[model samples]
Target: MSEKVEDRIKELEERLASTKVNKATQKSINFIKFQLARLREDLIRIASSKKGGGGGFGIKRTGDAQVAFIGFPSVGKSSLLNLLTEGNTHSKVASYDFTTVTAIPGMMNIEEAKVQLIDLPGIILGAAAGKGRGKEVLAAVRSAELVLVILCFRSDGTINLSDLKTIRMELNNAGIRLNTRVPKIVIKERTRGGIHFTYKGHQLMDADEVKSLMNDLKVRNAGVYFSEPDITPDQLIDFIFGNRIYTREFVVINKSDLMKTPISPEKITEAIGHEHWVMISAKNKENINTLRHNIFMELNLIRVFLKPPREEADMDEPIILHRGDTLEKLCRKIHKRFINDYRYSLVWGKSAKHPGQKFDNLDHIIEDGDIISIYLKR
Candidate 1:
């Protein structure tokens, strides 16, 4: 059964590759893609039931946020790991490929934030298909809040574009969506009513097309709503799959010291067609501070201090929380009993309209350097 599913997926993929995508064949192409997604889900289930092949590094995640380094072997992931962390874990640095055989975890403390940095085994071609323990590496990557896709130019100043493309494809095939948010789709199953859908913005797939796709997937009755614009068929399919990981990613060009000729950052960006990038040479420790700063900024974390009523806020010891965390989240983190005995909160920071603003909204989003004073019931 697994073999048959694989064959069908291959055939559908080939057809998709061969077909020219335009208004004329867009529906047909999407239908094929939908079919392929369903078959792939089935294949995963089969693989899981068989056992012996499905496993991960099982690294216990720590720190406020987790960052992963993913790239082909010898792309300087190990050197970057060593430079980022304060000697927590020394990943073996080597000139050859595949130096790091397992997932190495390290702690990075910057901007008063503690982050977990993971240097995973380099991923090779056919990584999504489990080549060279690729499954284990990607499994570790899925847990990361941010992924640094490390790439390097050769000594002759020539970069291999195919390597970047392969890494992107492998991550995609592993259900890792980079630098994208989850599709704003809501699906509610129904017992008797037929499939119904309503979209707020420009609907990419019409009513009939969505109904047909859902029906083919054995979804008989459901009410769907879309809050985002320009939704593609693949996005809808991914929403249905329900196992995809949406994470942030940025490119890291390493080994810049080896470039024989100086390459302009603009030119490199043009060649790679990616705007979010940082150029650094881990071997020479060039631009290491810039990369560290970028990592801290990209993490989007905020330091918030809790002030006891009629007392000064603990400026020295602030709680580390992700940006946009609600006051309710802060209360829960402080203590579960606070939520039950909550009254209101006083805020002093950028998020407040004025200093010492009294707010009763528990869902108020806290900002950086915010000093929140919770007034609990006696």
Candidate 2:
């Protein structure tokens, strides 16, 4: 009976795919999917209930992770999106607030990662408490897997650290204490080093001594570092996401074009104290690829393209899948029923060494560039 219902839902999905469903209908489809997921959750409750009453809407949170762009107005949220996707979307940036009347979203290609970064209205203080456009923006921030807070370059060259605090407060108001939940990475112009660094609010002195300094501060397993300057982005990424640093933000120092009396890589490492920082100009197309790599490593995101049973493959029909998508999540995504009765699935992708490998749907961990065909028990 349950399998029949799943088949019916799949048929409905196919019909919906055939028709031109508007945004509302698409949302309805999501609602239906959510309802089915809720029903699945109610399995235990149903068994326990002697006609038990409480039945309400619930969310089936998937590993379909999302990220949102947030910050004060003219803070380069939209601009960063443009740089990431290379798509010309309207930013409407001004010196003051309220440039965007409606929220805009765009899909960005972070190398192998396909992330959707939504450009939201400028968030102000006290949004969750029902202050200005803060509420609307805060709601968007709450729905993200991670956040990129851009403190951009001004003519004066002083990035507003205070606004960072206020935006954080707004996030908290929206019930997202980003400091605790997600990894926060700060991107800004370099202080003196050509390399990147993280800001830990500590000052270091002496000759090539970060280890001795860590011991002095009693900081154990704080983060990883390269032995020399000019290390590739891969090394930096490994050093960053390799170990958990508790609550951390990947610090990137931008605007290398404007750094006066530039500092060496060692000095760059020291600028943010211990946090890793990357230097780049999104406008100038500088090291943006490296930035993308770091985000993928940090978020543990994987991108996979879906392939059909086949007629003739077209380059136009390749739909890239991203997010924190594991195999288990993919089963739920393809069909909620699959989640309930999933046996296993087979996957092949750019990352997989063995093509057409079978994976236990429950245990398979998805990686970037995986093309998968799920085999379910009919």
TM-score per candidate, chains pooled: 0.88, 0.52
Candidate 2 stretches greater than 4 Å from native: 1-65, 179-258, 261-277, 304-326, 337-343, 346-361, 368-373
In candidate 2, where is summed lDDT lowest over 10 consecutive residues? 52-61
lDDT of 1 by residue, 1-378 (tens): 655766777789899999998867877887898887777666444433332332257677888889999999998999899988957779999989999998899999888889999899999986665578676777777779899899987777766557888998888876789888899999899997899989997888888778877886678999988888888888989999998889988789898887887778788788778777888888888988888889888889899998999998899888888888999989888899889999999999999999999987689999999999999999
Task: Please give the RMSD to the true structure for each candidate, in Å.
Answer: 3.1, 21.2
What's the residue-level lDDT of 336 in candidate 2?
91
Candidate 2: tens digits of C-alpha lDDT, residues 83-174: 76676455555556767644576666654346666677766664443445554555555456667665554555654556666766555423
Query: Which pairs in model 1 have colliding backbones?
Result: none
